[model samples]
Target: MNDNLYEIFHNVYEYKDKDTNNHFLLTENLAPGNKVYDEKLIRIQNREFRTWNPFKSKLAAAIKCNLKHFAFCENSIVLYLGAATGTTASHISDICRRGMVYCVEFSSYAMQSLVSVCEKRTNMIPILADARKVEEYLAIGKVDIIYQDVAQPDQIRILKINSQAFLKSGGIAYLCLKARSVDVRKSNSRIFKEATQELEKDFEILEKIDISRYEKDHMFYVLRYG
Candidate 1:
């Protein structure tokens, strides 16, 4: 590892700014010189790294909170649900440079931005469709990972449906569950518990991280689909 860069996971690097003494989670820029969501970029040894903000990305928050399972690889085929404006999805595109990131978004407003981001990165495929309707994206085939960040009341059901449709056996999934979206009336703990129970029926819970510090009323789950 270079002195300025530390490999936290495959293609994921940690960069500490010398000026502010602030450490940042970074991914090698797959599309060099291109700004995704206006994230800061750094150059070291002729390589570019994009600072992944935890506040803007739940996966970055999970990593900052010590998430153990890092399943993304250079060749990972990812199905990213709720890829709003391609913020987190862009980072995954950097990590999985040799693979594919199928970005699904329901909102036309968000999809417009996602499409521009996809145009720059060849690995990311933007899909304008609802995540709950898996049949629309069945052409993507089985994927190595399913990343769901949808904020609907039936978020778990959406994940289950997509997992059954596209997730490969023993594949990994990163679920960013928004408790308030599930049930604003119920407590966050109660919503998390119920969601976990529902997920346990289809996936083995590998690691669970409470990311309320970065994203309020949200629970980040790393699971293995069997």
Candidate 2:
């Protein structure tokens, strides 16, 4: 079952039990072959997620599964950690037109292309730093969402720190965690379960889907502060 933006946020029943939406009408349209991927993203970064590996970021799978849950109002502030090469980040920037995107990438290797991408795009502030030291960027606080796509073992811990420091009271977040990154010996389900437990302490988990066909043994979990 593909989860659109609305289903991710509104239909989860964690926030509310009723399925008020018609499932036909859509406010945030992120359908494949839509203008979002074609016209807008190309205009902004001059490229989208073609050359860069989707194996790295899970947004493509998120879009494939229905990207509606990612919908946010205009002018929203998004904190993106592990923004490699600015490919997926470019797509997000296009979707969130008129919004502020604060991207944090630790590797200088990807930053080479990312810097060039950011030079042309506005509202994309690229901060080269380890996400563990997220306190450094908390000065620019109260973001609408925090997107964590890191390949580290302690991602949940870092996201909690960043969310407490930067995310607004009712803000949302997305975590694209590599289960193998945390525990290679354990099964994918085991790793995901542990990570989910860690995340449930602060936020309400809207959906936890297996994203192995499009990617690897990774899971894209949509969360929000309760």
Candidate 3:
């Protein structure tokens, strides 16, 4: 379990940030007669497209590490940054069953497709806006967790802004860092270290993993507000 989480952390950050398309939201190959889901809204071939938490995937590395501490409850609001096309965000919506999942996305092009898919559901809320400019809409309220999956060059800076304005103190956060987006010339460790330093200033980092086994080029970080 420890090894898997570490590998996933790296995998999620190694890929170049790109717009995603064609991937099924929550449809992954699972066991027969062992489907696990809450209330099903949409079905394909009589099977549900949701019901997958980290407990069943390489992305599950984040939960195993207890970085964001999402598994313990099904009732906290999560402010998701960079909800491109709502891929992983959809899975989060499944896990957060009773809670609200607010997806904050930027690309108007991506939002066009994402909004169409999201409007079909009730739990997920799509906000087409810049993550860096979170304060503008943060008046909504504090969030229990903030998931940062943006691909900007200044990932840490934007994260800090959201943490300050939206995240309630004592809440948790997950940072899915893409190495290519941060710095391709230096070693991945160096970039990770730099971001950790910035976060440690105000957060209590729980775990930092490689996660390369699940994602091609990426890293996943879990932190708790101090």
Candidate 4:
């Protein structure tokens, strides 16, 4: 409700500091006083908002880079792959307060931190499993959106497999492709092109964003599962 605070997307907001002229992307804090990854919290009109750091999250970076499609809603179920420490997932949790975010992570070390964050944010569910193994977490059922940030040679294949298993028809998917993970020798453009081509086989590319300013050699793809 602050005059400086503007809602950009559903539950997402932008706050501008008058004196400093610094703009920050924020989400209404779902856990009120809880802080995830030490992000700054602000209070406006009796509502708490958590600053979403674009430097720390590819999804936030994509939003900064003018990402057009935001399919996430207050009750949209999300399957978040490679949810390390639940930074972005927590923000998504704030957006989808009534829905669920199945946080799938491979590293046990990361899962420990993710679990702690999930505990504070009731909407986020921590799943300790590799993203490549979709069957391991099939009980999550169909989701409205799939957000993949896995770094692997088979990232495209992993997204396709998971989309087939969990994403409902016409559901949205956000793929954060790391070019170097696919092949160190290949150019970033080549890697992104190949990944896009593979994804086009089963999904429609809605938007392609270059998040290299925050994440080098990364191309963020917004796709709709067919």
Q: Where's the lowest-lDDT run of ten residues in candidate 1? A: 1-10
Residue 24 deviation, candidate 4, in Å?
0.5
* lDDT, candidates in the order shown: 0.93, 0.68, 0.65, 0.93
Candidates by TM-score, descending order:
4, 1, 2, 3
Global local distance difference test of model 2: 0.68
Instruction: State how far residue 135 of model 3 sits from its true place (Å).
Output: 3.1
Better of 1 and 3 by TM-score: 1
Per-residue lDDT of model 2, residues 1-226, tens digit only: 2242233332121111136643221222222233312222111122221221244447766655655566454577899999887656765664566787888999999888777777666767888888999667766778998888888988889889888888888788988888889988999888988889888999988877677877887789889875
Two-way lDDT contest, 2 vs 4, winner: 4
What lDDT is reached at residue 123 by model 2? 68
Predicted structure 2: clash tally: 3
Task: Tell me the tens digit of each residue's lDDT in model 4 across 1-226.
Answer: 6889999999999999888999999999999999988799888889999999999999899999998999999999999999999999999999999999999999999999999899888799999999888889999999999999988999999999999999999999999999999999999988888888888899999999999999998999999999
Give the distance in Å from residue 37's predicted Cα in candidate 2 to where it truly belongs. Answer: 12
Q: Estimate each model's TM-score.
A: 0.98, 0.75, 0.72, 0.98
lDDT of 3 by residue, 1-226 (tens): 2211112221221111134522222432122232333412334445433433343343454544444444323676889898877666666665566677888888998787667656665567889789888765775688888888887789988888898898888888888887778888988778887888888999998878776655545678778886
Query: Residue 135's C-alpha lDDT in candidate 3?
Result: 62
